[model samples]
Target: MEAATKPKLRVATTSLAGCFGCHMSFLDIDERLFDLVKLVEFDRSPLTDIKHCGPCDIGIIEGGLCNAENVHVLREFRANCKTLIAIGACAVNGGLPAQRNHLSLASILEEVYHAQHGLVDGFIPNDPELPLPLDKVHPIHEVVKVDYFIPGCPPSGDAIWKVLTDLLAGREPELGHGLIHYD
Candidate 1:
């Protein structure tokens, strides 16, 4: 009798404070994404158009937490995914967004809005539709336990592929010196 084939792993992904560059890098895998699709199914990712994540085997977070919504999504992913990987410098250490951490939120807001010379009814936005900004941006690990980290301003596609394939094979991922970097 032939051995039964294993089911594809369900994966979820999200971006927080940083740019969606990490997702772009994932897409940089080019034609190899077809191979990834064969190994895993996406849930609650921009690629899948899923509104919310259901039970998932892996979660890939690509940015840092900068607001209440990011916290909510990160917590939700933690609850749903058995293994979570922080991908890119943002998710691993707050990246560029965390640069504002040295300043008070009010000062940062003022610098962006009040300090601007544009003439208008300048006022801090308080729309309910917008997620409330946190006092400071934080890495994903500060909010939830991350099983793995892929370092880089945006990790290269090859680095991401290695991590994914290693996880699928149930082995501890070993990133080479070339792959371990923060830009």
Candidate 2:
């Protein structure tokens, strides 16, 4: 008898306003990444440098939405991915960037461009190529329907691996104790 060949899961990933730490944690899987490839394959990700996402079984998002481009990319992922997972504090709750949400956009811009205490670039940057920042950063769920969340400053590599394996196995992911935290 011959063993059946299981369909490989297609995955896509991206970072928005985040520090890309979640992706780093995913990479922390290190040698386990080889085992992962046996069960899945990347579609659009930093690993592949594929500019656009195609149809994928899972989409892992690693940051908060902070600009027009982020919103656009997130929507594109939602359209192309069957399941979307928000990873890290940034993707779940805007993370470090959300600290600026209390201040108005103008004030933040003024601090960056006109503050006497900082680098004295006298004018606010108005580059046509840059995407405009939103008034506030937002969690992935605010922008799209997130199928799952891996919460942490950056969820540990082991935690991420467990989730991925469980999802691939068609089981609801069981987050063990100490796997999730606010800080």
TM-score of each: 0.95, 0.95
Best model per lDDT:
2
* Segments of candidate 1 deviating more than 4 angstroms: 1-4
Clash counts for the predictions, in order: 0, 0
Model 1: per-residue Cα lDDT over 92-146, one tens digit each: 9999889889899998788677777883667787899999999999999998999
Distance from true location, Cα of 70 in model 1, Å: 0.3
Model 2 is weakest, by summed lDDT over 10 consecutive residues, at 1-10
Q: lDDT per prediction?
A: 0.90, 0.91
What is the C-alpha lDDT profile of model 2 across 48-127, one tens digit per residue? 97999999999999999999999999999999999999999999999999999989999989878888586765888889
Candidate 2 regions exceeding 4 Å error are 1-4
* Alpha-carbon RMSD to native, per candidate: 1.8, 1.8
